[model samples]
Every structure is written in structure tokens, then in C-alpha cells.
Target: MTDTAEAKRSGPNSPQTAFTWRHAGLAAEFATATDGTLRLVRLDRPGSTQRGGAVDARSHDTVAPETALPLVELTALGHGSGWSGPRFTGTAFGTRLAYRGHDSGSRAGWEWLTVELHDPATGLTAFVELTSPTGLPVLRSRVRLRNQGAEPLTVQSVSSLLLGGLPSPDTLHVHRARNDWLAECRWYTEPLRDTVADIHVDAHQHDSRAALALTGRGSWPTDGHLPMGALTERDGGGRTWLWQIESPAGWRWDLGERAHGTYLALNGPTDAEHQWRFHLAPGGELTTVPVALALGSGLDDAMGALTSYRRAVRRPHPDHTALPVVFNDYMNTLMGDPTTEKLLPLIDAAADAGAEYFCIDSGWYDDDTEGWWDSVGAWLPSPRRFPDGGLRAVLDRIRERGMVPGLWLEPEVVGVRSPIASALPPEAFFQRDGVRLTEQGRHQLDLRHPAARAHLDKTVDRIVGDWGVGYLKLDYNIVVDPGTCAPGDLAPGAGLLGHAHAYLDWLFGVLDRHPGLVIENCASGGMRMDGATLAVSQLQSTSDQQDPLLFPPIAAAAPTAVPPEQGAVWAYPQPGYDDDLITFTLGGALLGRVHLSGHLNRMSKHQLGLVRDAVSTYKTIRADLARAVPFWPLGLPGWTDAWLALGMRVPGGASYVSVWRRGGESELSMPVQHLAGGEVRTEILHPSAPDAGTAIWDGDGGGLRVALPRTPGALLIRLTQGAENDHR
Candidate 1:
């Protein structure tokens, strides 16, 4: 449905309805309706600073305008009235939006802009906040809605943001990713015309409007697809814009065409499609999930902007810079079955191999029973598995080897058979209609309740304080379906969203209390990986794919969604594997957080030595890892790509490259963006013993020729640009 009605413009000097907020190259202008509906007038590279001339809604004020958009559309449910229409009326734009006011500020190196709007009839106020680090070409947005009416209101849907007037709607392409357990981040780029029927060829000049939406439902936040999208002009300016909904719950974003141009709409928890609704009483307020938007020259540039934005918004943690090597006992070894004897040797071997943290993943609290999955909430150390002095004996061994000891915890759900299920008050758990909501033998906790928060707080404190544990692997393994219904005034979606906010607050509170503790965020691996969780957690487990051969693409593409320092990719090198296979597995992690695993204790001395060498190489390049931007030499990796490459450009003129050869040519030229027209020298940094391969810099082609004699091999190279005389 396209609306061709043009929006009325304000005066030349001061746009009564429009306001501009600028920060260096990026500028955002917002238009407000007399009824208080807010619209994104312009968001793009800053154009001219000239005054207005009928304010061409299409062109920015600047002479060399980037991309300019019209008012972003809104559609939602109204209390007494029904659904909101395409155009705004005094009280018709869904609950009748009204502009209140706006505020802006800057702190440290970040700038913040907030706009306030409300619906007087419904007494619902919406506050939109945009935050960005100074000079960064991206911004993060979040919305807060408050109900001030005398009666309760049912908010069916609300937008995190809506941007319109995008350039070249006809030639636009949408890019996003499809995610599953093992095959995560499988990205696809398709033309908007192809996805929407409106753009199909009819030889007519009619503006056929079409819409395409990407959404994620339920608790496995990223189960079906990533809450992210991108739009690029295929034949026009070629400028690309990307966005991510930083929500761990239901989220939706729509790309559509209207009379003005293309538009992008971002929202969290809707009633029409996602079964999400909220009941807001007088004086009550609910905050929407955050959404991040980035604009750059291309996909890589936009991704780079998002990367920097992720780093800026995340909670400051020492672990980000420390970049420690972690040894987990789950993949290729242990596999959830752990014992004192099995772990002691592994801990000793991990320490000797230079692992900084040793995590006893899963099965730790399980008794020797076949029904461990359903009987899991107590979190107590199993007497049978740790017959000799309990689990602490092994923890002591990990500390004795100078490594931090960590434990795996799936804290969100409690098993029905577990004693904790009945121990806690009924009000602490999620209840629908009158029954407690249970899924797969596990019950979800409503974090908004005091008792639920207390239970989790006690668990974390007991483990961190009494046990002297310094690291935690927090995992969430279940989906809560649509949501939990609040007992009285709230709907199921609102109740679930409330719990989500409280859960993060609890996580952050845990961090505030245990300042030195490091938390690794995992949800069956990479499923719950979003900025909201990653902002508070120290590291993110990229995936749980056990096949060494299939992990290269996942590890390589992790940086697209997370920072390299926080992307914990598993590097499990087993004894049965050949030297080439070991290098392939270990190489996958060298560019990101090196999460070391596998049966190192069972490996031969020679096999263990290779692991040690890889660890040493990681440590040398880790300092640069903290302040590096990722670049793909062979483009984004395919799930089964023959060759994959990831480059990290550091502060200095040097770049670190990690390349994997699964089943490709012996020699392939990989391009390096930064070293385009300069004389550069490249050196292999890993597999120092047996000749793994070599890299030769080609300044003319602006790339490096990498040659590996054997297939299934890998190489890590450091590239530095300098003249022959300037070289050491």
C-alpha cells in the first residue's frame, strides 16, 4: 500500500515540524506531526548547510546530499478506534501520536539525542533515544512508552524506529542472514523487487508498492534468522545502510515502498502477527528493545560501523582487552560427561598449554542417571561424578595451575523434577491463564518477581563468593513460546519483555557486584547472540558445531555480528587429528577469542606441543585483536566454502590475516584493502615448526599470494606496509 501524499514543509529558518541533529559526517532530521506523530525526515551523510527552499523533502539541505528520506510510516492498533491508517489524522495514527519535545547531550566521547511524543487521548507517551560515539558513522536507538491515562490501554505494537525517503527504491536490494544450530549466519542478498511483487515488470509507470518483513519469534532469539537487515542501491549511489534489532525476544522490521520513496520500519513485540500485546495501566511505562542503524560506503563499511558501535555500547570489561585463552571440556571431549579423573588431567594439560581459563562445561551438576536432562535445576556438584572430594578438588587443580576456574550454568529454566521447582514460590515462575508455563520439562522464571531474582542472585553470589570462582559460562537453553502472561494488568508479551529487562538488570547487577568476574554468554551457541546481551556479557560462544571441518565459516563470520575480542570460537585439536587438521581447527580461533577445547590430556607430547605453539601465536597477536577492525579478503565465507579468510586491521599500518584452505587451489591471491598501493612485507606467524605455507605481497594487485602445499591446511600471516629502506 503506497501513499503518495506529500508532507507539508515548515518555514525556511526553523522547521516547526522538522529538526536536525548533526555529528560530523552523519546527520538525522526528525519531523513531528501536529498530532505528535514522529517521522525520520533525513538520515544519511551530511549534505549542504544551506537554508531551505520549499525544503525539497527528497534532497538534504546540504549541496552534495547523500540519501534523503521522507516521513517513516507507522501502523498499529488503537484502543477504541481499531488499526491506524497509512496517513496521520488528529487522533487516527494508532493511539493518536502527538509530539511532546526533545533533548540532546554529549558525554565522554558519546552523543545522545532523545525525542518525546505522546498520544493525549490515550495518554501514552513515547520517548525515542539515539546514542552514538563521537565521530562514529552509526547510532543506536531505543524507545520507551508510558501510559498516563486513567484506564488501562492495550498496546498492540510500537516502533523502535521508522526511516523513510531512502534513495532509489526501484533498484534497492535487501541483505540478511538465515541462522540454524550448525549452519549459522548463512547470508543472502536479494533484490527488493524480487521479494516484492510490486516491482515485477509490467511495462507500466505505476508506482507498485510492496513490502518485505524479517522477524524473529520466541526465545531462541536467533533461531530462524538474525534480527538484522541491510538495504543497498544496486545501480544508483551504491550507498548501503544496515540495521540490527538488539532484542532477545520477538522483533520485526519491514522494508517497503511508498509514494515518497523506500522506508524501513523497526519494531519489537507486536500483536497482529507475533502474538505480542501489552496492558499498560495509568502511570506505568514500558521500554522498547534497542535497534542499531549504520550507513557506509558498502556492506563491509556498514559492518565496520556496526562493529565500532558494538564496542562503544558494550559494558566496559577487562576481559575485552585481556583476550585470555579459554579451555572448555565439552566439544570433542567430555561431551557433558565429566569426572574428577577426566578433568584433572585436562586441567593440567590446559595449563601447560597456556590456557588462561578452564571451564567445566555441562554435566557438572548431573548425577549418574539417564534422566539428567530433566532433573537439572539444583546446580549442586554431583557426588558420583566427583567422588574424590567433590567438584572443588578439580577446581582447586585448575587454580593451582594458575588458571581461572569456571562452571556452566543454565540459569533461566528449572526442571520440573528438580527440587528448586517446588522450593520457589509459584508467583516467581511464569503463569499463563492460571497454570504455570512449562516447556520441555522446564519452567521459565519471571525475573520481574523478587523471589526469582533472589534465587538467581543467590546462586551467582554463592558460586562466585564462597567457591572463589572467577568465571561463569551462563547459558539459556529453552524458549518461552509467545510469552508468560502477567497475573493482573499485563499481557503475556509485556510480561516476557519485563522479565527480559529485569534479567539484564540482574546480569548487570551481577557484574557490578563481581567486578572481576567474566561471564560468557551462550544460548545453545550463537542463538541469543545480540547487542543487548553481548553489551553486558564478556564473551559470546559463536556456535556448537562439533565438526572441525564445518566450523571455519562460522568462526570467520562471527565478527560480522560480534566483535573479534568477544567472539569465542572453539579451537578443539584432538590427538587423532593430523598436523594439518590441528592447524585448521586452531587457525579458526586465532582471529577471534581462542576458546581451546578437545582432549588435550589424551594427546601425545608432540600433539600437545602444536597446541602450545598455537597458543603462543594467539597471545602475540591478541593485543592488536582488541583494537582491530575485521575485513574479509575472500568476501563473506560460505558454509561450505573451499577457502575462507579473515583479516584484522590494527591501529598500526599492519594487518593480521587468518586463512583456511579446506578444499581449494594450492595458491590463491587474497586481497588486502589497506595495503592497496604500497610496498608491503608478509610473514607467517603460526605453524612455525613444519612449513605450513608462505604469503607473498603483491603491491600492484593490492593483494597477497598465499600458497599452501597440502589441502586442509591453514596459515596466519602478519602484513606490514613500508618501503624497502624503511623495513627492518
Candidate 2:
């Protein structure tokens, strides 16, 4: 037997059959040998010239007994006890048993495959589900364990996904990111052996346990580390495998060498790692968190496939296509201190600058006191802030100016001094030991309770239905440390997971009832940013970094985790800034959801013109944004890059590029992937300064060479398909 086996299934005697699932160039083949030996025969983008390139081709299982690999790598309790990789322990149970049949089907552009395995001794049946969309190069997977026997079973750990088999183990690079408070999505790519191989050398010395793992803990989904990672074949043909855990609780993924091949195992929470354990009573079941695995020829291709899949999974909303420019009175403006007098002029100025939605962010309900933070939860108009005609007058003024009115609401928590705190019983809040949990002077609301849901529904309906507010900026400020413990049965972490799901359910219900309303998800500036939350919310606040200079990198890297149309990038062009600075700030947001802020009312007529110009440019490119895929000219941005570029390529042969020159060289060259080896007409769509920069198409290098004679400049370039692939 050879590493590259011919495309064929196992012999008739083998109960293990082959399943070759594919979408375009991407293909994943799984085979179960006659002896219940399951192996991932293929997990790569098959070459176009390969025979049986069809997505539905039969699996190629030709590995000998010595080379056969286990379908699952990790074992929980008694599951997979005969597996080769690391074993995750529990009270009892492992997957050392025989294989059951499988169920598979396809519909609505998606195909689902589920394999069942039973540990006859413990009567614990495990089901593994793999789902992939028609055009996406990715597959989503999760594991479910059911207790079929009369006795209850205590489970500790379960693999969310287990994938074995890759082309090679030589020189494999692990690509991941280290995320933090202000700095988010900073990526690092290193050798797989360097990251996890040496961590357990003593235990994995002469075995297939050379493991590398990445884990995330706490309530903030991406607070410690991003829920995404990638593995690339350094010496092989640019083959890349990417995975992301969409769980909000503790999650981990491991890459290891096993059975002359490589394997990837992903899971969320375990009794061994996160003190997470659950009891599955007779006829009860539990499921692991969802994880996505993608295969592609290159990083960009893999990321693009994931991006397309994201758009398909997100909750459809008009805001996605409309791409309305939002003006929020917070950053560089009111700063959570909005008043009737202060907002009236800004509302008028925002409408003049073409802002479609004017959001009164924060302090709108605060009764002109410093203790407002502890007095929230009661979403009512403040008499002191709106002395003359109340908040309705300001909201009416916004509608009169031809823009939708939006309000800021932190509905997840109630303030310690909030009237609702005593109004609702402690059962409506998160409790550990009969006492409500409080963080940062805020009490976390458990949406699993009907009272909490009713409180929020009433507040939102009053503001939107009664006052005609069409938008809501929902913010989550504090992290619910540890988690809540249910009275007797559920773990604290399990309680937290239930509450998170219920919160999202409430959000979906709001959208169901209010079909025309738009909601923005903000968590003290992207702390709670994840696909699950974004699926329900209309927009994601990229960050809360007030400095305009530090915003470009975040905006540039946002598309890796979020869609361009849903990523609300703030463009705060203040009256005090020069023309170039204003344009630089505005350029950071031109390619994403333009979130306008700052003191627009105080800006001069000339200064206001820049805001209007950027808004006008946004309107022109917005329609293209809804259908665009992101591309990076200079690769992913670092914390401080002198030159950063983000490109959005639409279906047609047209593309838009936003370049920011923080402060460095006058001339810089960036290679555009789409325009490579072709000539394209390039023009600056939004010029930050009168003499911003000149973009020249370099045919020889296959890149757009930009020359900016001035420092701190920005340019939005439009590249159109050229006549002949010419060079100048």
C-alpha cells in the first residue's frame, strides 16, 4: 500500500464503505473497512485533472492493516478506547465497540452525513454529523451521545469533530491568532511540531500522540483566543485546512500525527480541562458544540469559502443589502452623554451628511447622574437630559430629517440600583448559590426566565413601536465570570451555555415580531463577537478603540471573522482633525459598514464636505458590498502597519480597494490577487487629500504600485478590467 492510494472502496466483506463528498475542487472521502476500521481517505482539493473528480465519487480506501487509521482520535470515558491518539477520560465508556449504520441526505444546497457508533457495554451510542453546503469548501461537524440503557451515565469529554488523514506530516504550519482587549485578530503561523509536539513528549514518545492544541475559556466567546485556526502544508501544493469552533463556552482543538498520517480533533469543554461534566440519564442525550472544517488550495481560497458560507448562514435582513450609513453619537462625540440640546444639531448634521440611521448611543436614558451605570435596565426617557419636550422630541427630529431613529440599549443586564433589580425575583438573574451574580455593578439577566424576557420585550416594543425607533444598539459591557449553577442538575458552565442560547432565541423572536427592526450586537467593543451572535444580530461593532490611528488594522482584519456588510467600522471624522486625518478615518470604514460618529455639528462647511463625499462614495460601492468577497493586497495587517490595504472583489470583473498609509514611505507596492497577470484600469474613488496618491498598474509584477508623496494619507481605488494584459 502507498500513501497515495487509487480511488477505490474497500472489499465487499468490509462493513466500512467509502463516501466521497465534494463541492467544486474540494473533496472529502471517508471509508470504513470491513473490520469497522474507519479512515479519512482524502481531505483535500482534488486537482482538476484527477480522475473521478466528481463530488459524489466513491471513497478510495487502499491502506493496508499496518497503515489503517482510526476514524476517531480522542476517547471520552469508554468511547474510542481502541483508538491510537490521546484518550480523554471520564467516569466510564469509550468508543472501542463496533460500528452501526449511517444516515445521509442532501437538501437546500447542503448535504448532511451522520455516522453512528455504539459501545454495547455501556449502552452509550454516539452519533457524528458532518454537513457541507453545495458551493462551500467547508464541512461542519458535531458529536451527540445518547444513553440508551436503563442506568444513567456520567460523561466527561466528547470530541466535537474528528478528522484523520492529510497528504503529509512534514513541515506542517499551524496558523492561529492571539486576540485581546484593544488588539484583536493578530495572526501567527508556525510549524505544527513547534506548537504542540513537545508539550506531551514523555507520553507520546513512540506513539501517534504528537499533539498541538488551542483552547478558549470564559464567557466572552473570543476573549482569550479566536475560535478559528488553520493548518497549511508548507512543502506541499499550498493545501490549507481551516477550522473554527462556534461555541461560546470553553473549547479546544488538537492537531496530532497518528497512524502514519495526521489528525485533527476539536471539542468544547471537558471535565478534565474546564471542570465540565454532565450526567446523561436513561433515554437522555447530549451534544458537543459545532465546529467547521474547510479545505482549499490556498489560504485566501479557504477563507473566501468560509466567508461565503457565513453569508448563507446569517439571518437575512434588509440591512445587509441596504448598507445604510449609521451615525452614532458616542465615539468622539457625546461619549455616552447625550442631551436634547447636544443631539438636535448633530441629528441635523448627520442627515445633512447622508447618514441613513441616527443612533443615540448611551446616556440617552441616564437621568443626568454619574450613577447611571448602576441605574440602567429601566429604559425610560430622562427628564433632565430631555428637559424641553422629552426624548420623543429628539427622535421625531431625526425622522423629520429623513433618517431612521435608533436608541442604545443594554438589555442583558440590570444595574444594581435599577428599579427592575428588586422588581424581578432572583430567579430571573444568574445565580451560583441562591445569590445573584453581579459584575461591574450590573446583574446578569438569565433570559431563560420568562420575566426577564418580558421585561426586555416591553422595553424594546415601547421604544420601537411606540416611538417609531427602527434601530437598536444592544451592548454587553461586563463578562459573567465562571458561570451560573442551576439549582440541582446543571453545571455552572452549562447554565451559561443555556442562557446564551436563550438570549439569541429572544433576539430572533424580536426580529420575528418586529420584521422591520434592525439590531446591532456590541460587547464592550467586540468581546462577544461570534458567528452565533452575528447570525441573529444585524451588525457587529468592530471595536471600541477611540484613537482613529489604531482603527485601520482592526477594520482591515475584521472581514476574516465577520462579513463586510455586517462589520460596523467606525469612521469618526472630528472637526479638529485636518482634511487628511478625516479622510484616513473615513477610508477605514469605506469598505465595511460605515458607522459615522464624531462632532459633525461643529465641523466647518469645508470639513463637512469630506463627510458628505465619503458618504456619497459609500452609497456608490454599497450595492457591490452585499455580494463582494474580501481580499488582502498586503496580506493580514499587523498591530502597526505603515501601509494597510483591504480589497473587496465583486462578481463582475470589478473591484474596490481601500488603502491607508499610516505614516511611512512615500511609495509602496501591493500585489492584488485578482489583477495578477492582467492589466486593469485603476482610479482613486475617494481621495483623502488633493494630492493623495497615484495608483499605477504594474503588469510585470502583477500588482498595483501606489505612490503617495504625503504622509498620513488614504485612497479608495477602483480597478476595472482592462482591454489587453499590458504593462507600462
Candidate 3:
């Protein structure tokens, strides 16, 4: 099951293949140059050969020193900067690393391969670890560096993964997603040659100095872009490489032309981009953030593999499978102004609508009538807002109505005017140059400090343990740019990295204490949606747009960035809205987590019936969501697309598709290759009314034609194979 071999040099001056590992369908080969520098020359699925064919046997000898990057790229304070390029290449420390040894092992269902390298001059040892699930075409990589010398080493940049031997730029295309407040996961594809232009390398006898780089800075990892990307062959070879950087803070990935073909560098916070530096004393060690790469025949296949990898690595919890429905009084209902008088009736309405949990979002702790945005450190109930038995009374009503109580919390910040701002010591908050860092009237808490962590733990325990709350909507509304720094820290970015890790640790601690509690991750609505946070949090709020018509694209494209069961899409139906609008909003969330919100207490019985019907339908199909793999029949949704479609397929069972007609024609046809050549039985699962929409399955053509008579209508359709083709 485990295979490994070491390559020996044929001659003293010739380049040698240092090591080769083949496991789980992935083959990786490391080569050592004449100078004894180690480089990862090959990483590919040998069984599924591409049109460009395997890498040349003599590429290790022909590749230029600048392009033949080491297996682990390390840049230190006193190292040689780089070659004649803007890229992070040709570092002296990276070039000096020589292959030491390697090992392979298997545990449970996962296999791992570790390659060790050493730099004699600085006594820096690098261990490159690569892991993957058995029989999967996916690989996760991370690097750990140890300083064994007498002198201290300050690391400015270290790559978690460095890959070479990709196809030429002319035969490749790149895909990346742009994200923002209301617009999340807007993906665009471009030719790799356009981003990293070919400067006639053959004529110049050298590779181009330019690189196509994507960098995310600050605490919001996905503020401007998602930490995910893909590169596919342009010749219809179906060779695709999809990758995701696992970090809650700053990260960067770049693709550029190298001597043999192309090279990719994935790293966490770096000195040039995020002012991050790590100080490693003698015998000290540090590990870089992990990154994952999945190879497949196409984009969808690669994404499916990546999805499985994501599900495998995340913290296991019942919430992922149970997927309980949540109702919050914030989106378009109370709007951060919740009171017992306002919530009691809403709680009853939510329970009647089958919401498993009811969360009183925001402003619950504010005694002031003006606002609670600025003064929000201490998470306590407001006596003026709660009255009589206080917030506990509203919670009791929710419990009485058959729903668990929940609360909103922003545990990382203290308002400038709040009492906790002064109660906590200055060291407990982020500070630089002896001054506390403030953003939008709030001071960021440095979770690395014991006082700040203890305060958060106390607040969470009081809310979850004492208050009997089962859900917590954790929201972060402000951004702390550059990062945080202290007297002993190497840089602000380094301090931010430490705080990010510490924050995750605190989250794990909270979950450990309260195993049944569900936490919703919200950072200004999807700004902090990254692999690292999604792996910990139970659910993710897709957006805060508040407009039902504008939410279709966001919900449709959310699965591309998050798992379907965890992407919480809001369904807020106002009393004045029609049945079509209600169904349109609710149908968008059927394939994902249903986050119900609205003025349900003020609606008529007829309107309330529509809401109840949607919830009932969600429950029927919710069990299949945890095992489904998402697909887009009409391709990734465009922001202005008149027709948007999201499909979830559960192998050997049935497939569910949610289609929305925003402002286009009456009919839309999309390809469904999996159901081709088979008889499919289709039915409308939501709205419960036959006249909501119409669908025609073109089994012969492997497509589905849908018609929504209304302009802004949506429908959830289920497709099950006929008995004759059930096994197919």
C-alpha cells in the first residue's frame, strides 16, 4: 500500500533524482541538481496522463537555477533576496537546502510522505509533509522548519507548497473568485498567458520576471478574494488543478512561467505583503499553514475531490448531519433592536414554522435606546429591553414552543466607550507603539493574552451553560488592517497570525466545553469565509443583502466556496410579499441550510402557511444534503445572470436542483450529464402547489428544461432515476 524509492546519481557531476513517491494515485519526484539543491520536479497523477505528456526526463538538467525552486522555499532576514524578478524566487536559503532523507507511512485511511532537507550553513532543517486520503487524487502539504544553529533566524517568508512542472502557459487557463460584502464567490476565468504574458522566453533565453499573483491581506481572509483557485488545460485535455489555502488571516499564491513550464507558490503572511516575520531562536521550530491541491479530469471533478477533502478534515459534529433550521430576528425583522415584547410572538411564530432554533440577534445587551453597535463588549441582557423575568423569559417562551434559545455575540472586540474596554488591561488588546489599535470605535482583543481569552470563555459559558442557549451567531463587523504587534513580536502580521491561531484555539475550547452548541460564523457576511474558519464553525451566513431578488446568485454560488450543508442562506419573507416572492426566497435555501427571518408574527394565516410549507419541505430533503456534492448545471452563477441554477447530487439516490428566474425569459434549459441516457422522475419539492413552476426532463439530451411563468420565481425540483435505471 505504501511505495517509496530513493534515486541515485549516475555520475558525480550529473543531476540526480533524489526521491520518488507514488501513493493514492499521486506521484511525486524530487531531484537534486549538481550543486546538491533539492527540487520537486514532478507532481502529477501518472495514471491519468495529460495531452502535454509527462515531464521531460532531462528537465532537471535543463531547468534554470532561477526556475528550479527548492521543495521548500524559505526566505530569511539575511538571505539573498531573489533573482532578477519580482517573484519570490532564487532565495539563498531555498537554494542551499539539500535533500537529507524521506519516509512514508499510512494510518487509518490517510497516507503521508515526508521529505527532509537541511541547510548546513544556517543549521535550518526543513520537513515537507504531504498527506492524502487513500485512493484519492488529493494532496495536502505543510512545511515545518527548525533552527539548530547557535544564532537566531528570522524567517520572512516560507512556502507551504511549491509546485513545478505544470503545462506551458499557452495551454493553460486560470480561474479565481472575487468576493465582497453583498457579492461573494464571483468567479472569473482567464487565459494563463494573459495574466503571465509570454515574453518570448525562447528568444531571450530566460524566463519572464513577471508573475500572476493573488494576495489577501488583513484579518478578513476572503475580503477581496476567496483563498481558492484552479488551472485547467486549454486543449480539452480535462487536466485541472484546484487548490485552497487554509488560513484565517493573510495568504498569497502566485503562478509564473519557469524554465520547464510553470510554477506555483503558496504561502501565508509574508514580509513583502503582510509585514509578517517569525523570530526563531536556537533549537526553535515553526510550521507553516497547510494547503490542499486536488487533481481531476475537469473543474467539477476536482471540486468534488476538494469537497471530500474538506469534509474529511473539518471537526466532526452532529450539526453537519442534523442541519437544524435556524430563525434569527435580525436580517429584515427586528434589525438589531430585539426586546422581549418584540421577540415572544416571533419566537412562537418561528416554532410554529418548524424552526429548530431561534436566535435573538444583536442589541439584546444594549440598555441605551440609541444603538448598541459601539458599546458591545459585555454580552449581558438589557433590563430595559427584557422587562419582568428579563431575556430569560423570552428564552423560556422559545423553549416552551419547542425550540432551542440562541444569542448573538462578537467576542473579539470591545467598544471604545464600553466599560470592558477600560476593565481589560492594555496588553489584553491589540497595541502597537504603546497605543491600543482601534477600528470603528472598537478595540480588537488579542486572544493571545490570558485576560482576553478568559473574558471570552466566561461570556460563552454564561450564555451557553447558564442561559441554556444552543446556538451562537458570532459576528465580526470591523476589520483590523495590517495586523497587531507588540514589543517582542517580529512584526504586526506575525502578531496577527498568532492571534488568529489563538482565536481558533479558543473556538475549539468553547466547542469542547459545549459539544451540542452550534456556532454561526459571520464576518460582515462572508468576509471571513475561508477554509480555516469553515472547518471549525457549524454554519456560515452567506450574505446580509436583505433583498430576496438579489440573494439568488449569492446562494447559488455559495456552494462553490462552502459546503452545502453549512452555507446558511437567509429566507426573509415580509408580510406584504406575495406567495411567489416567499417561494423564491425560501427555495434558494432548500439545498443549503435554511436561515429563516422576517416579520412572521405580523403575517396572515395564508402567508404563514407558505412559510410553514417551505420549512416542512426542507426537513424532508435535509438529510440528503450532508452527503450531496454540489454542481452548477448552468455553470457558476453570474451576478447579473437572469437564470441561476444549483444542483446537489447524492450518488445512487436522487438529485435536487434549485433554479431561479430573476429577470429573463420564461424557460431555461441546462445540461445534466449524470442523468443522461436514463429515465428520470421529476417532481416539485417546494411550494407544495402544482402551479408554482413546470419542469421537463430531457433524458435523451441529458438536460432539464424549466419554465417559470413569473419573472422573479424559483423552484426546487427533485430527480430520481426510473426503476429500470436505478442502478445506473
TM-score for predicted model 1 compared with the true structure = 0.91
* lDDT scores in order: 0.77, 0.76, 0.85
Clashing pairs in 1: 35-98, 36-98, 36-99, 47-62, 48-62, 48-63, 69-165, 70-165
Better of 1 and 3 by TM-score: 3
> Ranking by lDDT, best first?
3, 1, 2
RMSD for each model, in Å, please? 5.2, 4.5, 3.2
Clashing pairs in 3: none
- What is the C-alpha lDDT profile of model 2 across 182-215, one tens digit per residue? 7777777788777444443346555444477777
Residue range 458-528, candidate 3, lDDT tens digits = 99999999999999999998888788887678899999989999999999999999999999999989998
Question: TM-score, each model?
Answer: 0.91, 0.91, 0.95
For residue 418, what is the lDDT in candidate 1?
A: 89
